[model samples]
Target: MGFGDRWRQWMMSCISIPKLSVLINGSPTAQFGMERGLRQGDLLSPFLFNIVTEGLSSLFQKASNLGILRGANCGNGVLISNLQFADDTMLFLEPRVEYLRNARRILRCFELAAGLKLNFLKSRVVKVGMKWSKSNVWADALLCKEGSLPIPYLGLQLGARSNMKTFWNPIRNSIKKRLAPWKSKFLNKGGRLILIKAVLASIPAYYLSVYKIPAGVANDLEKLQSADGKFSVGSFRIQLEDSISDFSVDHKLVWQDCCPPKVEIFNWQVLRGHVMVRQVLHRFGVVQWWEVSSCLTDSIKTWFQGWHGLCPSISHRRVWDTLFAAVIWSIWESRNQLIFNGEDPSLTQAANIVKFRTALWFKHHGRGSKIPISTMLLNLIESCRESPPKKKIQKEEELIPPFSLGLKFNIDSSARCSPGDVGIGGILRNLLGKILGMFSEHIGVYDSNTAEMTAIHRAVTMCAETPGLIGKDIDIVSNSKVTVSWVNANGVGSLKHSKIIYDIRSCLISLGNSRVIFNSRASNSFADCLAKKGSAMEGDFLSREFQ
Candidate 1:
């Protein structure tokens, strides 16, 4: 589930007359408008075979060139699912959603002009933090920042999750990923034949039987494999160790599905405390222009701007605006604390009166207006009030899927209390209390939402890549109601929190079109407990094996 997502790329060079049909479009006579040429004894369509071979040959050449050729810079964006075939590429990036309509239309125009049309339903835009993943690799796992994620490429959701259904999904999807390496290693027509057989044999019977996987239905494949194995899918069980020879139909047909042992999971968390004093700063105003107006030395004034993520290398106007905003907000907050607490205030009492006068002079002479100061004050308080209070929130709502199943998919964010890092935990179990594989990870934090968002990104990726985490319906436990609601809904959140909504949507799509629920924190104790295992959330982790 990294940048390349381990896609199945077949550079099919030579194809057999009959086999090519099943490999790509399945019986071209019926599928490709070619029914007129088929007869009971007609030789396989040599014409189709020739056309396919040439295409595969050309595709392999591109792929081979790609090995030595550094791929194009999709820019500060992610490249995901292929548009139609293996050769087509999907790319993404971020920006605001308000402009998305225009962007999509523009993209559509270029797509048509570029000889490829985008499958709109398959393309997307996730509203994320302005700088989310700006300087990093696809953290298959993410530590998303607060606000929305811009999944600016295909509509395929491209974010994170904190649920097990998404986290362990790859294990379920392993059969497909397993064949990826084999296919890429040999793209020739003869090699593709062997690849097809290996792929056919590699599918998980449980995956097929229950039809939870995108592959074949389990019951039918079971009949083809064994007479006794033909049980109802509802009653079928997956035994990965079962050999193909057990089908009772071959001279020593020893075959194993191409599943690799799962990689052991490792956990990491961020440090405690914020790099900036947001709370104290909040006690002031959001924008502090007054500081620039106050009497301060040029050196100290310059130092402040650098601390708040402003580039020192910008133009004079840019630098002043940066420092101006910081100072105004800080001074405004100072005035508020004093006014609210009934403390005395006097700019005249400062020892640095000379600098204070310089600061005041800069502002008075400048064409700036803090006239909306009262209005701004009202907005800041509302913003702070809307954030779920840190005193610990535990509210129970009606249980829903991806957590509605009797088996619990516990989810909780650790970074809420602990600074810098956060963690998410998920587990699936049967009524018998046997623990199916449980997954948990610590995500570094950029904001309160970042950790929660990272958890979400992981969840979606996990469920999409793995199988058996969910079947029909399941329960998903979480401490964050906002996140659960956002994921379950078919659309984005309201204007204020749309970005978070968008990012969550991108990740949830991989759940293969299922509805997940938001349960209270207490109900999600298993995940909550693990997530709050605190900053000590180090080392390889798995739940204590349950009976």
Candidate 2:
């Protein structure tokens, strides 16, 4: 039976159409039959709405194949179809009468079968990429308004660069609206911090997912902190310290969370206003030596602009991004220390911190990091300089052994920093080294070790579930010695990762014939690449790439 038929049967058998009290302007008009289908506050309303409209998608697909309906083709060779979210639908079709008639007929069929009506007047026919003189004719036929591109779809301002000033207006306006009421109320330092952290910071977080805040928007946001901005230097110091503690070492959210959205580090240097930061550069004699200005921001803008003018490649860009983040964080930390302690913040100390932090961050998070930390600390440019020709990497003997029987699985995980975005990936291979299956997932906010262990556990569980693997000996390979040691020792691990170790042990027990072994990171390159890609993803996701 069709879904509509099934739903109708279920409704008839289960639901009662009792007369609902009709309230009109504070008075009951009269008792009426419950004519409309869904309850006003049904929890399942959205889900049911999706189910009702799901047929429309298939109908459009069939029509597209039959050449009765058509959609715009993307540059990537994918056809654009109607976008749907619950009841809201945007149909993409050629401005042809036949397509319009078929769309109308499909809607009519759906309305009759599902007992749901589409509001034609509220819907708009939007034309994209092409100017259509007959747009009105289609609008009339569809009985909906005619619209154009640059219209709002979902919550995003649809047809513009996400970082454009127009795109940030809503976020700016929202901040203004929130600040208006709070401005009148006298909030103390603690209360102001609370409001900023809880209410103000959360307002733009959604937008942060796609676009980095422009500098003007960021400055505008910082202006909202005017009350706290006027605090004594000591108060400022304490507040800065407290807030910094809450941020991750990488300060990803904190950095990206604020305005002037994160972009190329070179651009960030040019855009940010660095008032007191010149002191650090002057102390280091960087500006004087680099032949840049006394103005810190100007000097940075000059230095980086010249650097990028050299047109660095992808490898060079990665190195610069790490060095920039480390320097920026160190400078900010030093500024806070200068204020709080009433002692001069040593520029040398800040530079050293930058070197240390950048080295650590690059070692783990940097994809294909080639430059050594000693070279990066001493002079990043020197490391990037074209070196004397060297021999290419020679093929090494294979360290990984082919499984003689059953299955062999390799797993790896990546995280940007401790308690940061993490991803797990695993690949299953047969005795012939043919890939059986591969999976990658962006598991949110886990330490690196925990993520590694999770990857191992997932691999074991997946192997157990694989068909024809029952009671068969399976081998699991991992690059993480720590995770392998935990499993080899039967779940005993450092106190910090005890929970993950226990889970790994449990998964191993379930796969009774499984054994964990360590492999060099080079041998496990495929899983490592998958883990890196997964880490870049935003949410918890599991993907099966092959089977």
What lDDT score is found at residue 26 in candidate 1? 53
Looking at model 1, residue 267 earns an lDDT score of 5
lDDT for each residue of candidate 1 in 1-547, tens digit (9 for 90 to 100): 1223233122121221222132445534432323223433444444444433343334433433454112233546533211223344332223323223333444455556444455544432232322345323222113222333323223222343313244224433564455455544543346365555555456554333433432333433433323221344433433422433243212111111111111000000001112134333544665444333325534332443344345333223332332333344445446667778876646644323323332333334342234233432333222112223356654432232243335545556676443455666666555444555466665555555556655665554555455654343434455677766666666664454577667556545545344456655666666666666632466535453332
Q: Mark the regions of model 1 whose C-alpha exceeds 4 Å error after superposition.
A: 1-407, 416-419, 494-513, 538-547
CA lDDT scores, all candidates in order: 0.42, 0.67
Candidate 2 lDDT, 177-295, residue by residue in tens:
77766655544456556756568778888878877777887876765655543546545655677887642122232233212244234234433434435555777676644555555
lDDT of 2: 0.67
Kindly provide the TM-score of model 2 when superposed on the true structure, using C-alpha atoms: 0.34
